[model samples]
Target: MKLIGSTSSPYVRKVRIVMAEKKLDYRFEAEDVWSEQTQIASSNPLGKVPCLIMEGSEAMFDSRVIVEYLDTLSPVGKLIPQGGRDRAAVKTWEALADGLLDASILARLEATWPSRQANERSQAWIDRQMEKIDLALVAMDKGLGDKPFCSGIHFSLSDIAVGCALGYLDFRFPALDWRARHPALEKLATKLALRQSFTDTLPS
Candidate 1:
């Protein structure tokens, strides 16, 4: 098995964390998605990062699909619930967190475009996206406040998704001080980081 992605991608980081937690052995092929000669386009028609190529089968793209498949591979430390309302909650968390990351990444790339500058950027749009992100963070804190994990006591895919989202905010929006403002959320992130999965897969 081989995983194709770049280190700086949050979605790739999520897949890497799942692989580590599953204790799976697979070759990692880091590809620069922007390069003209990159293989990502061949493996993934969408030309996306975090494409998982199995030994002799079609590769898997989309972090959600890849992570779900990985959870099925192991009976230990299940990252997603088997089936129930609990599963729905976990998926919802993952969706919201991933959405926040999607918006942030778009805003970040646009801000840093060669012809673009901070002064030329639209603070109004960025602020609106951030408002949504903050609201999601607060909702996550309220919904998963007492639990050790997002869905329950056991760690699930939600934790991985949320952790990656928060990590990206720290990486790209350092001025926000998310940890300080949201201590409960920070605690979750801190605790999750102690796990080998999170520690090993941190974004570069």
Candidate 2:
């Protein structure tokens, strides 16, 4: 198996953490999605990072899909639940965390464009994304009140996704001061950071 992505991508980090937690070994092929030489389009029509190529070159796009498939490969960590409402609940948390990252990445990229930097419309769009991120942090904190992990006591996919999302914010928006606003999340991030998986996959 091979994992294709950039270190800076939060989505990629999610998949990498899943792989590490599962104790699965795979070749890591880092690529710059923004580079014209990138082959992401061949494996993924959307030309996205975090594309996984299995032994036979079966390409898996989308971090959610790849991570879920990887979870089934080994019983080591079992990030997602097997069945029942528990599975849905964990997936819901993953969706929320992924959505938060999606918005943050969009806003960060939009801010880099010189034209968008001066355009009120673009700024408004970025503001909306930031608002969504803010609300998501509050909701996550509330949902995580007095819990050791996001979905339950055990560290699961929800924790991995949330950790990656928060790490992305720390890497890109240091000025946001999210730790002060959401202490619960800060605690979660701090604990997860001690894990080898998180440390190994930290974005450069």
Number of colliding residue pairs in each model: 0, 0
lDDT of 1: 0.87
Question: Scored by CA lDDT, what does every candidate get?
Answer: 0.87, 0.93
TM-score of 2: 0.96
**TM-scores of all candidate predictions against the true structure:** 0.93, 0.96
Give a tens-digit lDDT track for model 1, residues 1-204.
899998889999999999998888888999998887887788999999899999786889999999999999988777888889988889999999999898888777667767776788887877777788888888888877777878788888898999999999888888988887677789899898898888777778
Tens-digit per-residue lDDT, 125-186, candidate 2 = 89999999999999999999889999989999999999999999999999999999898899
Runs with alpha carbons beyond 4 Å of true place in candidate 1: 117-120
Superposition TM-score, candidate 1 onto the true structure: 0.93
Which regions of candidate 2 are displaced past 4 Å? 114-117
